[model samples]
Each structure stands twice: as C-alpha cells, then as structure tokens.
Target: MKALPSSSGSSGEKEASSSLVIALGSSLGATCPSEPPMKARRSLEPVLLAPWGSCLLALGAPASRPTRKSDSFLWPFGMTTALNRGCWHKSLAMMATAIKLAVRALVEVEVRRKSERLALSEAVAELGIRDVRAIGLAHRLVLETLKRLNLLDEVAKAALAGEGSLEDLGARARAFLRLFAYRAVVEGASRRELASFVLSAREALGKGTLRPIERALGRCTTLSLDDVLASRSGDERLALELCVPTWLLRLLCRDLGRQVAIGLLKASLVQAPSYVRVNTLRGEEGEILASLEQEGIVLEPVEGLRHVYKVVEAGKPIILTDAYKEGLVYPQDKASCLAVEVANPRPGQVVLDVCAAPGAKTTYMAQLMGNRGLIISIDFSRRRLGAWRKLVARMGVKVAFPILADARFQLPTRLRADVVLLDLPCTSTGAFAKTPSAKWRLGPRSPKNMAKVQARILRASAEHVKPGGVLIYTTCSLLVEENERVVEDFLRANPDFELERPEPFLGLPGLRGLSKAQRLYPHIHECDGYFIAKLRRES
Candidate 1:
C-alpha cells in the first residue's frame, strides 16, 4: 500500500485560523459564533487517558488542574486549537494519535449501530471522569463527517476506481477513510494536517488496520467535486453537491418546488441559529438579560414571541453559561416556541403533554400558564423521563407531573385536559440544519411510516381534549404526510373539531385546503422547518 505523504512545516498561520472556523463551523454551527479567539474555561477540566478521552483533549482543553463539579458542565464548544494548544496533558504526538483513533472508533461504531447518539454515549462512557470538551470536539468531528457522509461515500466509490467497493473494506478502514476524506475534501485540511492524521492513525490503529485504504485516501485528496460529479446528473448531481440523499432530494423538490427545496437543502450545510426561551418563572426578563450580558452573552429579541431571544453572540457555548446551567433559559428552536404560543394554554387549565421528555415544550407551557396549570407529561421512554425530570427541575417547572406510557395507545390517564399538546415525532426533515445526520437515517417511506405513528398518537391525544378545548399538533417536518394530511384525516373522522388560525401565525398556510394550519420553512424563517395545526373541539 502507498504510504501517507510526509508532513510539511506549519506556515500561513493567519489563513489557517480564519479557515479553521469556517471549515469546522459547517455543522458545529452556533457552537462557535464566528470562533473569536478565546481561552479554555478558567478551571482545568479533568483529561482522562481513555482513547476517546485523549481525543477530547485534542481541541486544547487543558489536560491540567482538576475541575470542580461546579465548573464541570460539559457541552459542545468552539474547537479552535488556538485555545489550549499550549497546555496539553500529553505530547502532541500522543494527542494526534488519540484523535485519529477516536474518530475511527466512533465512526465505526456509529456506522455499525446506525445511531450517533448511542455511539457518542459509548465514547463518553469510555472517557471516564473528564471535562468532555475533547469529547465535544470528537462529537462535532463525527457529526460533520456523518453529515456529509453521502458525498464522501460517493467520492470514495469513484476514488477506488473499481479495484474495490467501500463495502469490501474492513469497518475500521471504512471509518478512517471517511473521516480523513471529509477533512481533506470537504474541509480542505492542509498537507500537514492530513499527514498528521495518517501518521496518528498508523500509531493508534496499527498500520495493518489502515493499510488497505492508504492509497484510496491519496487518490481521494486529488479528486475535485466536479470529478466526483462528472458521472452523475440532475437530482443525483444536486444531491451530491448538497450532500443529501437522492430519494430525499427528489421528495423535497416535489413537495417544496425545486427552488425552495434547494434553498432549504443549502441551509442545512451551514450553522443554524441557536435560540433560548427566557424562563420568566425564575427571574424577570430584564434582570436576566443584564446578567447574561454581563457574562458576555449577547441577545436579540424575536418579534411576536415574548421571552424568546436569538443568541446574537456568546463568549462561550450557551449551555456552559451560568444562566443555562441554572435553568434561567431553555435552548429551544424558534419553530418549537411558536407551537407553544399557538396552543396558548391558560392558567389553571389541565394540559396533557404527550410524548413530553427532555421537556422544552412542557416547561414552556408552564411558563405561559404562569405555573398555575397541571401539565401531565407523558412519554414512553424511562430514560427520557429521567432527563425530563432533570430539565423540568432546572427550569423550575412545578406544574408538570410525569408518567411513563406510550401515547400511541390509550394514555394511562383517566382525566381529560382542557388542552392536549401533541409534539409528535416525524422524519425531522425540517430540523436538518441542527441535526443533519437525521436526513441520512431517513428513507423514502420514512414519512409515511412516521405518519402512521403520529396518526395513532394524535387520535389518542384527541381523546383527552375536553369539548371546546384546543388540540395542537406540531412536527419539525415539512412533509404534508406528517402534518396537514394527518390533521385532515383526523378532522374527517372527528367532525367535532374545527381548524382555527393560530394567533400570531408565523408560517405559510397548510396544503390541501388546510389553510387554517401553518407551515414554517427554514429558508423563509431562518429557523427549523415545522408544521403546526390547531383544532378546537366544537362538541
């Protein structure tokens, strides 16, 4: 096998720093707002020696002084090496090897399991007790690699030049090839950067494990986007250029029209805006704004929505701030906030939050209800409820009571509520700007399949809405199958419910004559793609 090219001395530091932010920011988004030069959080985060643990330190989280619990909230942050390059717990040689191995192992596991969340959990578990700054770096690396995986895999098949298929390669080799290809082809890593990666992988994974793909990496680095696109055309060409799936691209074109679909597809390539709902329950908005401002967190209020603000800039990742940790604000999408506002739950009303785990909406409903209503939070996953418990506690949501049960069937609750909020699951095509990996996991039939589940949950949730009460159905999906069609089918069977305009309508009118419903697009709103339908029971 051909060996990796030798590393050159680091030159053009100015160009490298500016390009680093733009390259890594593709999927890591608001994690680093413009990636201004900054330091690691003041305290030294524990840098464990696990393979992935070492990788976590690759981005310059000081491997020095032990951090206190109060100082140790791990969250994704800017991965600029300029931050902690001087304070590594180990030698650069070792950290480089750790980085290579960590990416390979995580990518391999993610490919095998088909779940980025699970893959991250395994890596984090192996990390032991360290600040997960490096883990966050690793996660961002994996996400970007995965986000552009469709394009990477297509180029790989061509780069092999028929000697072998990607499927024939060993899983670890496949993982390594994809990771480096992403760095070189997509992010345009320098020869020094690519050489360091190869040498590091050789040391960590052994030359034997990566030997099969060395030549492929060499071939891949020489190829251009046009070279990869030469053999493809039309939907296929656009899909490759956009790094989206062929079938999904066709669907978006058909549903959203070619121009609008292209706009939405292009939006997924860049960072999405991050938003937070100020929890007025904990403190007044004015005082909270001053505190966040003092901490170097900047904000711009979203018009038409009370207590919601777009993060204009931040000194660090929002989740790491004292305001976020204290639960003074909730990181929620603007589309999500619009749904809660549409529901407009009143104080003292009984509301059932179906499938409400990790409680952004549930907590927001409490905020609107002024903590006076009873919100019965229902979800099937015990693990999710556990998280929901912590989130609700942090948000100071006193009105919500959790129950573990599937909303697809009859809910366990016997009492009816004045409001039933169904933030049902979907293919998540609209939220791709934030979670681009989800688009790859979906299939052509994925929407219809999810629609079936959503239909069941909606019917069950509709069972709990009292007469004259409101039933709000929402999804982070632009497809009609999951939104208007489901609502249309529900209305056909249950004539007692009539569609009503959501106050402060923020999106386009729904399709198929469901004009009362609303649809929000990322291209139009600069937010997650969403569909919201409100039905008032007339019985």
Candidate 2:
C-alpha cells in the first residue's frame, strides 16, 4: 500500500532515476540496442467503488468530461463516491470486514443453486455501473473470498433460504455480498462499520439472521472495530486466513492430490514475485543488467528463466524508466517467457501467435527472432489489439504484424507460419492468485466448455503452420481437461502433428501419458500455473 514517489522536484531525483534505470537496463543489454527514457501505463488501483450511474471510471482514470457511452460502461469503472467531491472512492483500509462478509454470502449461494452470473449483472446494472471490468473485479473478489472460506453452501442458504430462485435472489445476494466484501476484504472495516456497509444488504436480504452468526459476534472479546477484525473462528476468521473453500480444496485434491492442493493454497497466499523480461531486441542481457544497476533498480536473477529479472526495489514505476519506455524491457510472467523458448523461433522463422493481445508474447517472440523474421499476431478483439499496438510502440517491436481475426475461423489466405504459438484461452485456474475471482465464476462445466473452444482455436492455428514447422500449444490452466487431455484429443485426431519436449526447461514434466508436455504451478514452481507443449508437423 506504499504510494509511489513523484519525480517532480526531489533533490536526489536525478541520481535516483538514473540508478534505477541502469539496474533495469543491465538485463536488456543482450537484446536491445540503446537505453531509452521510461514511460509507464498506470495500473488500476487497489480500491474500486461502484458508480452511481452507468459510466465506469478506472481507479486512476484521469478526470475528464463525461461521454455519451458512459452508461454502457459503468460496471467496469465502478461507482464513484459522493462524499469526496468526486475525489475519493473506497480506500484500501476496509479490507478485513468487507472480504469476510462478501465471502460468507457468496459461498452460501454458490454452493446451493450455482449459476448466478445474470442475477449479479442485473443487480450491478441497477447500481448504475456499466464497467464490466470493475464488475468482474468486484464479483471475483467476493467469489474468491467465499471459496477461500469453505462456507459457500452455508452462506448461500443464509442469503437465499426464502428467495427460492436464482433470478429472485441473485442480484440481492450480489449487492449484499459486494457490500460485505468491501467492508471485510478491501476496507478492513470492523463489525460496527460492517453493520453500516450492509444497510443496503439488509433491505434486499431480509431473512432472519442465523443464531450461530449472532452468537459468534456476541462472544467477541471487545466491541472495538479492530477487535472484530481480530476475532477468531467465524466466517470472518476464514477470510483472514485466506484459505481456499473446502469444496475447491477437495476438487484440487481429486486432481492434484491433497499434498499439492495444500501446497498451492499456501503459495497462492504468498505475494506474487515481480518479474520482467528484458527486451533482447534492444541489447544483450549483460549490458541490460548493468544499465539497470546504474539506474538504481534492485533485481535478482531467476534461476532457469533467461532474460527474466525479479524486482527487489524501485524508484518509480519501471515503465517510466528510460529502458522500459524505449522498449528495452517488458513485464511478463517467467512461465509465459518459457513458452517462446519451446517454440525456438529462428532468425528467419515465420511465427504466428494466435489469440495474441496486449502483445507480450508477440513482442517477446519478435525479440527472440532478432526482429529479422515476420511474426503475425492475431486476436479477435480489435480493442485489445489497439492496446497491443500501444505496447508494440512502447516496446520498440518492429517485426510483428498484428491482425484482428478470430482463431476459431479460417485464417487469412497467406497465413502459413513456421512456428504457430497457440496460447488459447482456458479456465485460467492457474492464475487464481492473480485473478482471485475466477474461482467463483468457474464450475465443473468450465473445463469442458473451455476445452471445446480451445480445440477449435488449436485446430485453426495448427492448419496455418507450414509443413515440418513447429506448433506450440499452451494455456494458463492446470486442469488436465484443459491441458494434457485437450492435447491428447487433438493428437489423436491429427496424425501429422507429434508432441515435442519443451526447450530451456522452465516447468515440470506434464501428467498422464502426455508427460512430454510442460506444466508449471505456483505451488510447485512458484510461477503462474501454466501448461505448454510443442508439436512438430512431420509432413
């Protein structure tokens, strides 16, 4: 929760700035050509409020005149606060109480009826917020918290015993759950504040309070807000521990076994390490590391992850560093960087990154090829591609050509590629730590649905690969259905493509009969849960 220092007028700013950039730049010396000034895209803030109207404003989105389409986008930006002259929304201090309530309510409902997406969306709509992104964020927070607490069914029964239908109680539960989550998880507000936050919740969910809930709070050691946060053994206690829901824990046990699930849950609670890939197209790794050292950013080498550095300290957002602004380095996950290594892009190789957007892998592959080959990056989303363009511009990627197209359909007539990287979308179970909300939105049916879509995307991408070229399939999900199982299904249907071992060895070997496929997990490898396999076209 520490605020970033402004670069304006600090006496030591100049010296600190250069030192920081140098430390960052040293990692990019092997790939990039020259050091450049830093420019950063601001990350969305930690606290978000539901908007009063449809327009959604990003936590740090600069103040400006309202637009006509604002109503349609409300759920994404969140509801702004009325108290601070439009200056303040919710702050990060209220987490303890908000998270606990949100989890308690969400888990209770999900365990009973399931499938509440539409009801939640409608309730958020009434709140006049249109920003789907913020809605998604808030929804995820409640869902993840519930899953962590093992009270999904308990909370649902408490929230909806009388409502009798998903459509009837869904919105009411979501609104109430959001308030409770905000008070517990994000605001860390105490029981008294928790009572206040649930004012709206009380009106919508008028069921009699559970006697257990009453006794649990009555036994609190003190009435003070901090005491409520520190109280043990209620649903709130579970929120503080941040454990995965008992059901999810059981599901994980069924798949990866109890030991691995416990290990992963422990890992999920740990703060994700910050890692960035030095743009090899800009300079060599040695020179980049030295340059970054001169700039004062502290970094440590990650074992087995080439061109990746973990940030220990920083003077400014790395994006503002001259090295980053000039496309000398890009922030990417270490596991994702490994996928390109498996692709083995040669200098003249023609590569295709299907589903490429926000361009991390696209740019990384271009750098791997020394900017000498053609790389066509295709995605169905134009807006996402526009964002990718911004990254390409910032990262100084020159060889990649981004196209707007769906991977489930036929590729363009001239779409053949030497290396096709099919990083198709999946359940994203591996990214639970980064995206805590998916646990709520997901179900047993998620993998089956996602696998079907992935199979289509994979087949389309595979068709575009040139004879004897390599096709790399990957996902950020650990599910066997989404990972090895999908690959097995594809392999059975396509005889010309043979599975190949991953290069540079970033992940552990895969499971079942697809052991040649590479899989990385946060619990085991301390990286995003990822699955990657290389397939060679025998021709």
Candidate 3:
C-alpha cells in the first residue's frame, strides 16, 4: 500500500517506523526470539515502543511481540512493510457498513412517508455523509433497489416462504432485505459476497433484528430472476421483465399498441441521456458551445432544433461544469424544448406560463423571446415558485414575473396574453426512464383524476388567451386521457379555440383524430415521452 502523505519530516519518519513495526509483528509474533543482531535490534526498538504497536497487539498479534527487544526474530513472512492485510479488510468492511446504513436510512424514510414520497436527492442530502464516493454508491444502491422494488419483493417472498410475508418484516429489515436480494439475485453476487454484506447489515441493524433475513438470504441467492419472470404471462410477464407495474403496463397497452407499449416500458428501464438548451441570454450558440467544449463537454446539436443539444460527453456532472455554473447552459430535455419551439413566442409577445415551477419551459420561453417579452409565471405552490425564481435569476431572465396561484381555479392576473402555456400536472408516464419511482406511486385512477385537474386548468387557461392567440397545452405524459382527451373536451366546450399543427412539427401525430397535436416517445425520440398541442382562439 502507498504510504499516506506526511505533514513534515519527523512525522514521515515516525509513520515509516510505525509501518515497519506493524510489518515485523505480522511476520513474527510473540514466539520471536528474544535476541537479534545489534543492527536489527536497534532498528526494531523505536517501532516496538510506537503507538501502532498497540494496534498490532489488539489484532491478535501476541502482546509480548511489541515489548520484547528481540534480536533472534525470524522474518518468516519476508518482513513486508505494507499495510497489514487484516487492517485493510477491516477498513473495507467499515466502508460497506456505512453504505448499508445510509441505504437503510433512506429506504426507511421513503417507506414510512404517506402522502409525499421523499426524493432520493432530498434523502441523500439529509444523510450528512461527508464522503462523496460513499454517498454516490449509496445513492445508486437506493435507486436500483427502488427501480426493481416489486421484483425484489417477489424474490423476497419466495425466499421467505413458510417463514413470513415481506409485509410482516419491519421497514428497516425490509429495506435491508430488498437491497441484499437485489444484489444477490439481480446483480448475481455470490453467496459468500452476500454473506459478508449481511454480516455488515447485522452489525448496523442488530443481529437479532436481522436474524430472519439472514436465514432468508441463503434462499434469496439460490433463486433465479428468470424463473420469477417466466411464471407470469403477457402483461404480468412484461411488468416483471421491465420492472414496471402491471396496471401501468396494461394502461400503456390500451393507449399505445402492445408493441409500442412494450417498447416504451423497456425504454423506461434505461437511463435517459442528458440534454441542454444553450442560454442565449448569457451567450450565443457558438460561444456557449465553445465554452462547454473547452470544459470537455461536447454537445451535439439536436436535429431540427437550434439551441437544444444532446450532451455527447461530459467529463463531470454537466450541472457542475463551469459552463453550467456560469449559467451558459440550461439542462432541458429535447422533447421539452420541442414544446417551447412550437409555441414560438416572439421577442415582444406577452406569454403566460401556467403551472410554471422549477421553470424549465418558462426559462426556455424567456430565452426564445430574447428577454424582451413579459412572462407571468404562475403555479399553485409557493415552494416550487421559489425554485422558479432562482432558475429565472440564474438564467438572467429579466422579463418573467412569478405568481403563486392555482391555475385550475383562475389566473392571478386579468391580463390576457398572446400565448398561454398550460403544462398541467398529470401521470408522468412518459418520463419514467428518468423517474422510475413515479411509476409505482401512480394508481389506476391517476389518469382520470389527473385529467379532471388538467381539464379545469385548461378551461381556466383558455380564458386567459387573447383573441387569435395560441394556447399551447403540453404534458410529460403518454396517456390519452391527459393529452388528447383533455384537449378534445376543451375544444368541444369552447368553439372559439381549435387544435392546429404545432410549428416545426417534430414527433408523431397525436391519437384520436388530434393529429394536429404532436407526441414524442422515449423509445423513438431518445428523450422523455411528451405531448404538445397548439390551439388558436379564433373568436
């Protein structure tokens, strides 16, 4: 092992001497001869009296090994002066213990929450762990465990057959078991590797508390995921295979054809590529591209879009890059950029962004408007609008004002705008690749419930559009109820507004005779699944 950097000459010498003592003790224990050559005895003297000698003694090295001024000691193990093997193993074990504890803590919090699901990022922030690498590993473990939660539960059930159901296990115990089973079955960890992880879990969660799981872990390793997937058929089989809920799979099949639905489901299992829009407020396209490239972030311009680029390679997290910190680039998805493009807000138009928070589309619209137009951004939650304020400020957007109001009821201001953007909340089925947790959180009634909310917001937003002004409705959802159905109902009730083809026509035509509207699918677009429709108030 490489010696750690020392503070000064004296400390360096001491560390070297201490390392030597540890090496000698490991090679020759208490049975070492009492007398040695004069040179060896003097060399070993300072090491024997050093503080590290106590550590060697504690690690099962004979207590007398450090006390004796030995001369006749035999270097049976070649007197290697590297770090002790047992100490290295113990250090690794401690690291694993910390990670398991962090994962368990996050999982427990998520499981216990009733109304609000704690985001992984928020959970990780609360951990207060100082080690960046360990935090990243724990974050990855939590995500993987949650992504395959249903499958893990099934595996755990089979493993715990005749013992107790997975529901009977306590939250912490269930978290630990899900994590372990994911590694053992999905990751294909060996029985011995899993046993070590379980031992670490036992130390963190108490041996008695983890006893039932310890017995079940052996059975967990013996099970095959293929067998579990093979047991189900059709939608059930697809759900297990893709780690999606059966209800979601059936819904997708009903909306999109079976082949297309399966494709979307499979695509959701993979991580989506990062896409960003150059902040024209700060720099020109060429300037931002050159700046990001200098930072080792190469971006490919998205086809048919000017400002949007797919991050081909980012040396680090793109958000942390100097280009990003300087507010030269805003990470917005390609499909999302398509909606703002279709809206085509001019430099001096008044745009109202209903349901604007965490302001991706709002900022993008501001960028397109050349920071010269008035944008009234409104959302129901003040907390989310606070984030919008930060994003607007970061992007140097001066023309946008944020309002805290529920768009479903009415707009905060009486002023009608040239363009009204209603990006309503709905079942986020399209963006599942990026947000797997949302898949399990949604239920059968989610689309219908969300459609009702979307319809109210759409009708309220329609009242805010000026004569002949465009009302752009969009959502990151593939469900027809939230997309086509909502728009169809809105147009039926309001004769003045009619659906028109979104400009720069990117994405496939919408379903249910709403062909003028556009839909982007994850499998086809290589971006989040999304829907965009442009309606003109003819009056």
Candidate 4:
C-alpha cells in the first residue's frame, strides 16, 4: 500500500489541520472522563481490518484541546485558553458547528474559487483549537467504513444531500445517526445499532424549523433506507450496489463480465490488505517480523510471496518504527511485488524503472540484485524522487539511482539494459477501495490518454533494452486499454518483441492474442487489481 501524496503544511499549518479531528470528538466534549476505559478493539485479522476500522472511527471523531498537564509543550496557547475558560458543552457545540462548516468546505468548496478560500482556512484553524488526532481518527473511520462496505458514495451522498431532495428526508436527524444508517444499509452495519444512531442524531439536531437542513437529512435517510432494504439478502448484485454515476458503472460492466464486474465493485468496498515487503537488504524476513512483534505488530504470511505479510495489528503509525525509518520494510501490495518478479532482475542485470517515484519496486529490484546491479529509476518530479531517495537510502539499496525526467521521453543517454520495468501511470481503476477520490475525479478519456502514454513509454524504453532483454509493462489498473489493448497494439507495431510468460507463478492469462500477459483482480486475488506482461526483444 503506497502512501498517497498530501499537501505540504507548516508547523502552524499542521496545528490548523486539526479542525476535522476536533469536530470528530464533539459528541463526547469535555465530559469525556479523564482516562475513559478504551473499548476493546475488534480483532485485527484479514489485512489489519480491525485497526483500519478503528482508524476510520478516529478520523470521524472531533479533536480535543490539549490539557495543561500534557507533554508536548507546542500545544497552542489559544487552545489551552479555550479549554480552561469555556464550558465543556459549549465547546462541544462550537466543535460541531466547526465540523459542519469544515465538511461543507471540503465537499463543496472549489480550489479555484476565492469565495471558498476563507472557509478552507477557517477549517484549518479549527484543527489548532483541539486535539487534531481525534479528527484524524474519525476521518480514517469514514474512509475505512466506506471502503470495507463499498458504501463511499452512499455515505457521501447522504452527507451532502440537500433539503427537499429524496435523500434529505432521511438524513435530517443528527449527523451520527445519518452516518450510521448509511453504514448499516450500505456497509452491513447492524439494524439495532443503526436505529439507535438515528434516534441520537434526531435528538441532537432536534425537530427544527430549518427546512433546508431537514430536507437534506430526509433525503439522506430515505436513500440510505432504500439501499439497506434492497441489499438485505446480500445477493452479489445487491451487495455490489454502488452509488456511482450510471454511465461509469455501465461502462465498467460492459468491459468486465457481470459477475467479475460486480466482484470488482464489491471488492472495492472491502478494506484493502495492509501488505508489507521486508527489506531484505537490511535483514531477513524472520528478523523483521520479530522486530515488528516486539512493537505489538502482528503479521499474517501471504501464501506465495514470502517477503510479503498482511498486517494484523498495526499499532499507531507503523512507519514511525525505527525499523521502518531504517528501511527494514515497506508497505507494498502483493500484486506490485509480482510486477518486479515478472521483470526478473538478476544480480548483474541493468534495469530501468520508468516513472519510479517513491521507489518501492526499484528498491525491491535492488534487493533482488543484492545491490550489485545498476537500476536507472526515472520520473519527472524531483520532489517525488526526494521521497524515493529517502526510501532507497533507508532500505540500504545502493544500485538504484533516481533520474528526474519524463517517462514518455527516451533516456537522454544512449544505453540499454537487461530488463526494463514500465509501471505506467493509468486511471488506477483497480485501486478504488484504497482511493475513492479517483472514482469521482477520473474521466472516461483517461484510458485512451493513458494508453497513448504507455505506448510512447514502451516504444522509447524498447530502444534502450539490450537484445534478448525483457521489457515488463505493468499498471495498477484493470482497464483493458491500459492493460491488454495497449499490449496488443504495441505487439502489432513492434514485431520483434514477443510477449513472454512470467516465471515462478504465472497468474491468470491475458486477453486476445496476449494470453502471456497476466491480469489480477482484487476480489479474487485479495490484492490490488493489476496487470503485467513480460516482453523479450529478439536477439
């Protein structure tokens, strides 16, 4: 699981970022007993599903102001003042109001609009007013809850529904109630709990004269009720019920078979497996696992890939561990690990990792080479490469070097390598569960545009590959144009390169005449939906 890129923030900005966290804890307010008994967390099985669930809940809770006695003296004086002077319930109301405003700003505010600028800053400022950690926890819950149940759109829609809309009638209750029902109907939340949540929300919001708010709540509730009732039986069709744009779902269903399409959609709702790749350069797998266990982290060994493990109990930020900081392990998907294997980098092999930023596979290849081979890793962004360098150094990888250059263009110097790994950029449809933002932001034109880009990269990289060397193409995408279709077109134009079978374990075969290429689906594989093809240049 690669970390998503986030916006840059300052020390002050980091403090301001707690607005959402503060909002998340507004329900309990100051009445939160000092040292309230922590509820027993759910079992951390199936790719750290329980920890991931807790993460989301934490994100949804409001942030809290720092207590005077707490460590970390950087806590804002204004926040301390708020805590010391205000009534706890008054703080709760303020937190709720701030969250509502922040959510609206997040969902509806446009980046280019000046009118939204103030709202965005206001939201950020709220974070500094309370413990931002609680907000982060709540946000995590919102994401995990939706992902695990394939209910992101349903929840988002309910959250944003307007007054007088069908969704509004049902959502008019308190915020938590509406959210609970959305989870219940769309994500398999229990009915009794959902009912209780609904009642609580109603009590919080009260039967007010705010018609727009009422309408919004009503529409949200009604839609959620319909979805829950419709999916009561857990039929694949019912379970895969998505609130996606009709055209998108139609296109996806057309490309993939009905059952497989539904499976892909449903799988996106399931929490992604928290897979970690041990840094063989630092220590063996046993040593890394032992270190992790010492910190209360548990791992489930994946069947085929010995280096990979499904994180069972991920405590706090696992990346913060000294082992991780020292580059002992990295979080990577099994499907991604397989891509490098398909490339088959050897000890003395010279390879090219195009668009290799944050260098997960590049380092993996370096480790496979025992740090003896040369790997030219190229990407256009220096900022991205900085992160790659950080990881490379941490992992003790010496052979791979980063090149800041466009992937579409040929390498500046004339050189060929034994293997060329092209993990081309695509629409990333296969990663919907982990990144719901892509679902809403990506357009239909993405596949065609990305196909052209992959073609250019393949053609350029082919010129550099030594005769008899392999050129492996891969994408974190399931779309045919970016996967099978791109390969088909490339093979037709470049007759000298033939698609070759991947070694060790050959996954499900490809489409059309490219059966040698492998395609993996998240639902079936319990990994990211991915595609890989190994092509060798004729000697």
Which candidate ranks first by lDDT, i.e. highest? 1
Worst 10 residues of 2 by lDDT: 1-10
Predicted structure 4, TM vs. truth:
0.69
- Measured against the true structure, the TM-scores of the candidates, in listed sequence, are 0.82, 0.63, 0.80, 0.69
TM-score of 1: 0.82
Provide backbone clash counts, one per model.
2, 94, 4, 51
Residues 1-539, candidate 2: write the lDDT tens digits. 00011222111111122222222322322122121111111222222223311111222232443343332212111332333343223322122223333334354444443222322333344444433223334444443343343332333333333445324444434434434433343333333233323332333334343211322222221122233334356534443344554455566667787677667766664445557889877778888877777777778878876688887766544655677767777667788888887887988888998878768888888877887889898877664566678777776778888887777778874778899998777766777665454565566676788888888888888888889999999898877887788889999999999998778776778888777888888877767888899999987
Residue 312, candidate 3: C-alpha displacement in angstroms: 1.6
Error of 2 at 40 (Å): 41
Candidate 1 colliding pairs? 56-134, 56-135
The number of the candidate with the highest TM-score is 1
Off by over 4 Å in 3: 1-118, 190-209
Ten-residue region with minimum lDDT total, candidate 4: 9-18
Model 3 residue 170 CA deviation (Å) reads 1.3
Better candidate number, 2 or 4, judged by lDDT? 4
- Count of backbone collisions in candidate 1: 2
Residue 464, model 3: Cα distance from true site in angstroms = 0.5
Error of 3 at 523 (Å): 0.9
lDDT value for model 4: 0.58
lDDT for 265 (candidate 1): 77
